[model samples]
Target: MTTNEFIQKLDGLFAAQEYGKVESFMLSALEEAKEKEDYGLYLSVGNEMIGYYRSISRFQKAYQISEDMLLLMEELQMDQSAEFATVLLNTATAYSFDENFEMALRFYRRAEQIYHLLVSPDDYLFAGLYNNMSSLMEKMDRNEEALDLLMKALAILKNYPDRQMEAATNFTNLGLLYLKTGDCNSGKKCVMQAIGMFEALDTPASHYSAALSALGEICYHEKDYEQAVIWYERTLEEIKKHYGFNLAYAVVCENLANVCREMERQGQAQEWLKRASEVRKRLEGENSGELHDIDNTAAVVNKEEKTVKTGGTKQKALERCREYYERYGKPILKQFPGLQGHFAAGLVGEGSECFGYDDSISADHDYFPRFYIWLDDEAYEKYGEELRAAYQKLPRHFEEFADTVMTPEAVSRCGVWKTTDFYHRLLGRQTPPETMYDWVSLQETRLATVTNGEVFEDCGGGFMAQREVYLSYFPEDVRRKKLAARLRKMAQMGQYQYARCMMRGEYVAAQMALAEFIQNTGSACFLLAGQYMPYFKWMHRKMKELSALSEVAGKLEKLALLPSQQDKWDEEKPERYRFALNTADEKVALIEEIAGRIAVELRRQGLAEGKDSYLEPYAAEVESRIEDPVLRMANLV
Candidate 1:
């Protein structure tokens, strides 16, 4: 095919999420485009390749390709073309995914400029730009700005004739905005309208699911648990049938679980809760922060008696928080009149009581009827201190809860923080860093320590969206890229170097190879987690709980300590031989465990988890150990 034809075809495949086919086709197509000196086709193919990289979330590769594409576009002075505008918008989206807000905003504005110059008055493309801009504003906590932009998009959508899907999306977004701003009525109106449009559209589209989900969210906020359950059930079914099970499906499951809990249908709630847990577990594949939420809910549903409840103090505290929310919260809403997304008050987790599961111990310090004030990262950054101050001024010394206080510093430390802080604390960085070691360590740390809060998850998607962003597996192409790298590393080091060291009687070096193999395999576990581990610690714990090597973390610890078998080494010693064999066996087990986890996570994601039939190939070189006695050293490195 001609380069332009090939580029167009590749763009079509990318839109279809056929990411796997992108590289092979693009390599050949790019070759042809370069050979034919087709600048337009070259730009198209380059941008399309960037999109493919982005969809699977290879941000670095996407950015690299985008830079090259942008330079080429500049070289050709092709920024005036509609295709170039679209490419700029797409590249901005790539930056947004990585939380590179500044760069994303730059590209988005540039695209808007180009789009305005290119498209006609009633075109729907601007609707998309506005929607995207609004979303970014929301992410940045620019609530008022986001709302204004959303309204503008709604206005534009209303003028468009053949943009039902975009219109529905706009309405849904508006509904969510209204819900966030405290205008539930307006939110409901917008959501139901969107749902109506979706039903009337007469096509099998994903927006119907999104609309149903939005309606469910509205019902949930209204405390209409029964209606909420119905909407959520429909959404769940539609999502599973049409989109299959994914992060969105998992979200509906969580909402359904919550609805069931609210309705006091403990049995049904438990069932749905279990389903939600499984979905969460499968999605995250490792324990994450949401584990505490699940554990608390499960405990409540299971009728486990609380260890401590001092004279209905808990209930009284909840009541006070609710009262404040109803009173002062409403007044605040009157001022904005568009806040409707989330309104909750609780002290569920992240306090002394949460971990202790008892109240009798101490209220000595700062423990009172304290409540969290949650806003999305964007809003929090802009108006968090103001909100905190406002919350503090609200009758802090209530009756017996006179010890109540809301210090600004305390609130700053206490309330739901920005995604950046949340991720950095959990994952060791604001953005997922680029490198295997960084990925592994971050996954381990994030999975190990995400839940330490009495989070007022007024952020609608809450744990759900966060899970998708951080915990969700790497996009396919990214996974393939990482997998290829890992395979290459393993082949070079594990398959070749270890055997060579053993053959050369380099016992110390051989042990080092074995240690390297274990570390690499452990790193692979992190890869699996990075790719599939969701935003909950408990889910990660569960995966580790299921692993064969999980029980042997202690053994591996000991293996790290056994003295090197160098000068006075005797492989014939029973204790040394036992340790060596056992260590080797355990290393094999660890590799197998990592492989198993990878396979399970991939299968859950509906991707091929692993091609290896067994873990033997990934295990330490047992044959080489036997042939070279000196190399069969124990715990050298």
Candidate 2:
């Protein structure tokens, strides 16, 4: 049979949902084409087989066939053709599914190079390539690059009316990317659009269910438990309606159980957990990751039930450390009478517990009765190992807590260390930054880590002395340069690009611009308050505690969670258009209001000489106040 005739028969089988027959039929076709010496039919059958195997998650089989197909193409002197590029794209996707990301990227790039030579910019082939390659980029954590490629694919796909499903898939991909980057507004908008498109086209239920699950995820992260449960239930129903008790159904059931647990509806949570466990057992077997995850959720539910029965509240890890220290650590150190004055002990460095942010969830790893003991370099050389051994001999169980089962990464977080080495591990240097450039380059989070937690004792004052240097905040010049850079970013991302992207209908890009604006504005607030911003996870929590510009954190959070105006923007009704325009105006006004607040703080601090509400002029003024000519002359951002 000809390639077209074979493809028609394959499509008929797929449409009939005769999935069990697909593999054998495709293999027979492939062999028959090979026997007939029909290269076109053979390549066509090979591509079909690769896609079929990949769809069934048989990635090794798909990859093996892809290798065979490529070798055959090269042997036939067809290595540079569009057909070869198509095979390369399929191979790359197979590798990606198998989690061999670097190899996937290599194949993707080779295919992209061939496509650039053989295809037009707006070709549907290029769109497919871009869409597939974007998935690989996202998996590799190159999010900005992934976003750009997805946008390119969307732009090209928009020109092909028959490719609406592809365009909708791109929207789904874009939404997930935005969600990954914490741009929930854009993510929700894109996902909703994809769902709408899928519904209108009457596409496969799986496509619709996936989008619903994504929406459920967004709600879960936003703490909208009611809405999360709603979306997840709908997704579960969709999956059950078409796919029965499959892995997707099990996963959605698991998601609902998690949301129910978060809502404290333990009975409902247990019901969902049981459902998921039952489906997982039948569909995925006992050894599957899905089963393992369900087992974990069941364990957590049982733990919470036990906690409730005991009338106990989870103790903060820092408090536990101090109590443990008082009970054991102090007496242990007293055993080393000669070295007592040389030791400084505290719980600090590289854990949520150190920052006092640890919760019940943290106990799975690195949450134990642990604290650091710092010794002077010479004292450590003499007694560090001895002290560590003594520390290990302490009672492992205290109160309701015990020594945690630690991963390899959590081994050294607590223990005896030379004072210099502890700081070196965290900051990549034993001493504080000595130069203006060094201060500017030092990550604020690193400084925050160095200064966090209580120094329980410091008889020699060595550890605290070194920490004091970091606690002093940035020098005035370095602060000005950093503040100026943050202001410039706020101006560019929030005040300028946000509006520009909105006008261009690039809602995802607009949301990213706003997210950056919020981030930099938060950083600027910390700079203005003469504080180090903690890690990203804790920045908002710490910002709310700042005496200076504390209200700005709430405003930034409001801006981030604002609902997208995409529906109104696409609406033809005049009232809807007006509503979208009004929302857009409100958002811009909020952005400027934030800028205005920062501008006032700048003048109050005497870092800038401007009454203007716009941040760019204030940024320029702040840069001008930098006494260090080197930083003043450097790029603003």
Candidate 3:
């Protein structure tokens, strides 16, 4: 290609901001420049490539180019000139971009010396140098020196108003300097002037985006929120349309989200932050700090920090499990690619630890900062011990908090376990049930325990997917059967049997019947509410907390507190004879009253069809609603 045409093509690529194409053109153009023995053109084009690399944060390449150019200059007997100063300045800025501040300062001083030797202090080239150095000084907290440098930059830039891009950059840096010095008014004016200049131009879209961002910050500081929002939106649009989603786009998104939040547009604010998070995640994956930057703001109400600080909560345990999965569990699969999809790690099961109810006292035994890692039976046989050993290497104490005294029986409770046994331990079956009769006999407390906690990583999808099936609400027929069984037992023990024992003056036996009555009736109350009961120790407490039939809890409490009908204050009475309360009729009446209340709740729920206070009649109504014919044939209690 001809020289003029080739240079124009390179210019077009640079203007398009296509750095890959720019690099390619420079590589070919360097050969062409060398072939024609055009030293001036070669040096100029090489300088452009170096600046382009620095612009895109490719600092190493930019530094290498400067070294190559210096060698060529020495070989070609190049004179000391403005071009040499440009190369020095570009190299200095490249080092600064990489945060090699010491190296950057050395190059900047060298470039300053070269510029002073060859040019006036008032020249635009010298002006840009001061602006660049000011930024470095500002980062070092040398604010006074940074301010002096920016003022010097503006003094030179004001002499060249037609240098639109240069003037805009000087203003941006000066405004930032003023901001650093706490001169908010001066900062706003400088930033606003830069934005006005940038908006009036059509070329140098990056200058416009930068100027817009500066205006956004100034307006935000002034509390002119509407203007800040407008400017930030414009800057974001420019970045997306011209430069794609980069670091600048993410920053603008975060600022816009913050502004929207202060304006009480919570949903809009969270959405913007979420968009910013997604962009960061797409660009850098889990390796990016940018994702962490947006996480707290991106959620509408971030509770993680709150829950983490309140240590020993269930959330704390879940967080620990999640951290473990992200650390050891995920990395193990990454290193052993064959193990991917072979096993799963999570917190689950009916153990108190699984439910996160184990406090300091309860934690003395089986509680631990541990979770289960489940595998299919085949995987368990093949890689079981290997994977278990891997988990054993994890820090024994999570954050210096020791777990319980673990034993051989507790091994499968928290570590790598077979899926069949994991389910069977709590669920009493190998896999998910196939029929209504299977559901008929499962304990409700077991259901609650199995479904209570979080699952951290389900790579295999085998273990968690099975749990999903278990979480499904029981079939209408199975629910009715379980409800019917509970009702039948409550009626036999509390309503019929208790009264029968009381009428026979068997008050001691009557209390036993009353205790059975309370247990069965509470179980029925939980069934009627469609809630699984917890373990027996917490059953009464949990039942009282249920939204449905909770008042029945109060009645059961009164029954337990009542004095026995035939025996009272026997130790305080005569040695041969004891005092009697003769409250058998009152005790029987309370039993009937509690049982009748349950029957009333059942009929109200349309789970039964009866008006009698006796619960046995309602059991038949409950059984009739059983949709599964085979399950309906099962025994009531």
Candidate 4:
């Protein structure tokens, strides 16, 4: 078939909404194009497939197809051509969706270079490029640069009367950007204009839904809960009609719940919350992979007799431990009367399950129905081995789930251990830190682990006393010193060095600076909340649980994951440096906003003296308040 005929057939299937059949049809077309040695037809079919997969949120497939297209383009020696540039733009978008921001920026830069060499200043292709590139810049927290490029796209799009949908979309984005930059009046005006355009054009439901949602967000921000509910309800209807129970539907439900709660409509708020939770649960369940039972009998019984089943309900490790203990541990301890009043039993240390954050994926290793039994040094010397032997003789299976096969090194995590030895292994000393230097040198994650989980029983009271000391959090002087150090790092890396690196076209260095800034900012937030930050892998998860700066976790995540504007920061083109500088300034403004929040918490806690949005002054103030001479004189990292 001719390429035109093939494309028409595909369009017909899409118009009919036969999405389930679309992938197979596209694959058949791609195979036919390949067999005929028709490279042009193959490219056309492949591009259509990539767009389809991306729309369906199958990002890995989209990315793989993009890679294949790029390889084909290279074999055809079409690197410098307009078609190659289009493919590069598509590939960059796929990379962005896959959260590979560095690679996304590299491809975007390559595409921009080719477009600069081949296209006119006012070409429609440049308008498309600017629109897509602006989105990446916005994701990267470069709001000012995003606004500029979006405006440029809107101006060029106005020259084409047939591109009203694209123009309206740009207006919607520009409004959101303006709101982000604190231009409330301009933001509302732009959004209203886009709403008018969308209504006039009778565009797809998603377009109108987005504009409604934007207005809903504005109303919610302005404390107009009633109006926010009205807008959000309208958006929810549109989303339900077009997209059903997808992520957008869940988000709108959450928005409505928040608005209802603010208006003190508890019943309505709970209804929305329940709906959102149900949608999210269903979505997560669909993606969690096939479930399997954990029967230890498979190891001993005949393989043919063991029935492997799918879709077993997985229990949290902590819950499983409690059940196992109730069924066997309490009875087993009764058999050893000498160990009765000398031990403390609980689950803690060295795993996500200890922090109550474990899921099914955690059961792959070092997970089982297990709990720690701590004994006083004398009690341990007298009966530790005997108690452990009794514990091991208990059943290996509970509720049809088997204990995980642990590595030799992990055996120490459970069973009987001398109380002193446990503290020594975790904190490197038998007692709590005595000096400010000692306190400051301990890893916050270690402190967090030692104090996490529940003490199911502590008849001896020794382990509980030591655990309570650690649970009291850091001394005031040591906390001040650590907070000061984190604040200094945030100021240096986020507010200062990140911008400097961008201006000098050190893209990789810019990324590193931003990463360090995020890390220190997160640590500072935990310190403000008077909570020890957990391990690096669980920091964001734990940050969400903090009462102070709870909202900051999402903002920090965005700053870390967003794609940088490498296209504008190209050192080879001196003309773009000014624009890159503006982008960097925009990011600095975001950093300052985060710093302002931190400063508010600091002032509230009497930890610093400052009305300044910059954190360096606050850092200095905090450091000066550290009364410990040694910590006060220590280097501020």
lDDT of 1 by residue, 1-637 (tens): 6655785786576457664566888878877877888776777678767765554445556656665565466557675777777777877776675565645676788788788898874467887888888877776667899898888887888777688888888788788888888899998999888888877775555667877888898999989888998898788767655434455666677777687778776666655555565555544444433334433433444343323223222533444545555665556544532334533333433334433232443354455545554445655666657666666666645545545344454443344345555555546576554543344344432443343333433435143344435433443334334443453354445444544554456877867776665455444444433323223323333334322124334444554555543433323354554344222433334434444544443332223423452333322322122232432332221
Write down the TM-score for model 4.
0.50
Error of 1 at 195 (Å): 1.9
Clash pairs for candidate 3: none
Q: Rank the candidates by TM-score, best first.
A: 4, 2, 3, 1
Among these predictions, the greatest lDDT belongs to: 2
Candidate whose TM-score is highest: 4
The better-scoring model by lDDT among 1 and 4 is 4
lDDT of 3 at 417: 85
Candidate 4 lDDT over 154-226, as tens digits, reads: 8899899888777877888888888888887788888888888888874353567878898898888889988
TM-score of 1: 0.42
Give the poorly placed runs of model 1, Cα more than 4 Å off: 1-81, 91-106, 116-123, 241-243, 266-637
TM-score for each of the candidates: 0.42, 0.49, 0.48, 0.50
Sliding window of 10 residues with minimal summed lDDT for model 4: 290-299
Q: Which stretches of candidate 2 lie above 4 Å from their native place?
A: 1-315, 402-405, 567-585
Better of 2 and 3 by TM-score: 2
Selected candidate, larger lDDT, 2 vs 3:
2
Candidate 4 runs further than 4 Å off: 1-314, 400-405, 570-587
- lDDT per model vs. reference: 0.56, 0.78, 0.70, 0.75
lDDT of candidate 3 over 536-609, digit per residue (tens): 76678677655446678888888888776554322323332223322244666777788777766564344665
- Report per-prediction Cα RMSD to one decimal: 17.1, 24.5, 31.8, 19.8
